[model samples]
Target: MPPDYPYGDKVSEPISAYAKRIGIKHETVRTQCDKGILPIIQRKKGTKREVNLYALYLRAKYKAEQFIRDFES
Candidate 1:
């Protein structure tokens, strides 16, 4: 079974899988990860990086809440 995160979804997942789950392009997710825009877990040198889904979800939720607050103001 996949690891569970407190917020939702798996604790971590491949960029491609994450992009697919969120209905975005794999390249977009890859670009963000490459640019350090998204949280990731790199086990070791030359290993595949896994997107930190929990962190991403929290970041997105915070941003959305901020947007809503700004809009309400």
Candidate 2:
């Protein structure tokens, strides 16, 4: 097992924490990472992977809500 797995030695937060916090399913997060939309995971020893936290997703939920508000106005 990787020493930095689930929670890394450098980070208290794991990828799953952020993904789930952003309303993404854990499985979907893995799938998206595999599909290349998410950051390319770096292979760690003992089968763990690391994601880049600096990667920003183009969040559109707020935009869609604003659009609806504008349309209804």
Candidate 3:
């Protein structure tokens, strides 16, 4: 089962769907999940993978900070 996040009941979704939403390849998202770079929920003994939107938000924020740093340097 997926976790019950406090983000208004919208917890997570399959990596494929999230990839589509973010305009990225599914395999790229899957790789990120496998590498533990992105936050995920494993359902049924890791048979199912779900990505957390909040985690993605954090990632985006971090990326934005990096971009700004590169811009400054």
Candidate 4:
């Protein structure tokens, strides 16, 4: 049954997925992290290792609101 998933704490997703979840494009996330705007460690596969979830959440929330306001009028 698909390993009986969603049964516990979820494993961290890939950088692209994380970025998408946070309202940032995959490339934008890569670039920002590369430029050190957000602290990110590299994994063995040459990908971002960790990112601040709260900061991502804040950015996503703010951008979502802004997008809504821009269209609401």
RMSD for all candidates, in order, please.
4.5, 9.8, 6.0, 8.7
lDDT for 45 (candidate 2): 54
Best by TM-score: 1
Worst 10 residues of 3 by lDDT: 1-10
Candidate 2 has a TM-score of 0.46
Write the number of the candidate with greater lDDT, choosing between 1 and 3: 1
Best by lDDT: 1
Model 4: per-residue Cα lDDT at residue 57: 51
> lDDT of each prediction vs. the true structure?
0.84, 0.57, 0.82, 0.63
lDDT of 3 by residue, 7-65 (tens): 55566888899899889999999999889988998867848899987776667778989
Tell me each candidate's TM-score: 0.65, 0.46, 0.61, 0.42
Candidate 2, residue 35: lDDT:
81
The C-alpha stretches of model 1 lying farther than 4 A from their native spots are: 1-9, 60-73
For candidate 4, the TM-score is: 0.42
In candidate 3, which residue pairs get closer than 3 Å at backbone N, Cα or C atoms, i.e. clash?
Answer: none
List candidate 4 segments past 4 Å from native.
1-13, 44-73
Tell me which residue pairs clash in candidate 2: none
lDDT of 4 by residue, 1-73 (tens): 1343331343345568768777978888777777888655456675546655545555666898999999998
Ranking by TM-score: 1, 3, 2, 4
lDDT of 2 by residue, 1-73 (tens): 2432333343323558767777888788777777876664465655655455433322244566789999999
